[model samples]
Target: MGFLTDTTHMHIFTWVVGIVLFLVAASMANGTKGKKITHMILRLFYVLIIITGAALFFKHMTIDSMLYGIKFVLGILTIGFMEMVLVRGNKGKNTGLMWILFIIALLATMFIGFKLPMGFNFFA
Candidate 1:
């Protein structure tokens, strides 16, 4: 139970995995054949990300909920666009727009995440 609330470790681990999976999914999207198993596993990783993210959100909420809220929304969007890119890529459809959206969402999410209180100190 305690692990569920303080999920920084789990969150970071899953976040790294999710990024790696995203790259795999993106590459597969460019192929003629589809990777059902990869997509399925990626979906599972996404759920883990969301669960840990929600836990982190509530655990670190502050007076200015706006920043956290923005991060929350962007995080969800990042997953969404990632999924979209996979789907479109499998269908051999144009995924340029989804790629752009996913990258923007990802960058924004990471920036906000690192800017949080006692968050990742890139300079450190």
Candidate 2:
């Protein structure tokens, strides 16, 4: 079942890679040099964060086996939100709230890799 184990890892990896690329490409398409660089760096960090987090998740996670899935969805949502609201128009019109939410989501996402108390699965 080595391939089966690899499937899950590959699934997560591909999804993360795809979303980051989509975000970076979208940012580049918008023609903002600063945003492009920032987005690219953030996207790279997003991949690294997920990769390292995956290792931690395998070692300590319990309760919600779906935490990774939830994080995946949130990653997509966060990228979409950034594209639609922050990067959509002026690219500089106050996005403090969006940035705050993005950072919060990223932090929360990182935390999901660790174990938590019983019967506290957010998805449940």
- Among the numbered candidates, top TM-score falls to 1
For candidate 2, what's the RMSD? 8.4
* lDDT values, one for every candidate: 0.84, 0.53
Instruction: Quantify how close model 1 is to the true structure by its C-alpha RMSD in Å.
Output: 2.2
TM-score of each: 0.88, 0.40
Steric clash pairs (candidate 1) = none
For candidate 2, lDDT tens digit of each residue in 42-117?
A: 5665565455445444544556567756765665565555555445444546656766676676566545533233
> For candidate 1, lDDT tens digit of each residue in 18-87?
8898898677635434567777888999999999889888878887667888898999999999999988
Off by over 4 Å in 1: 29-34
C-alpha RMSD values across all candidates? 2.2, 8.4
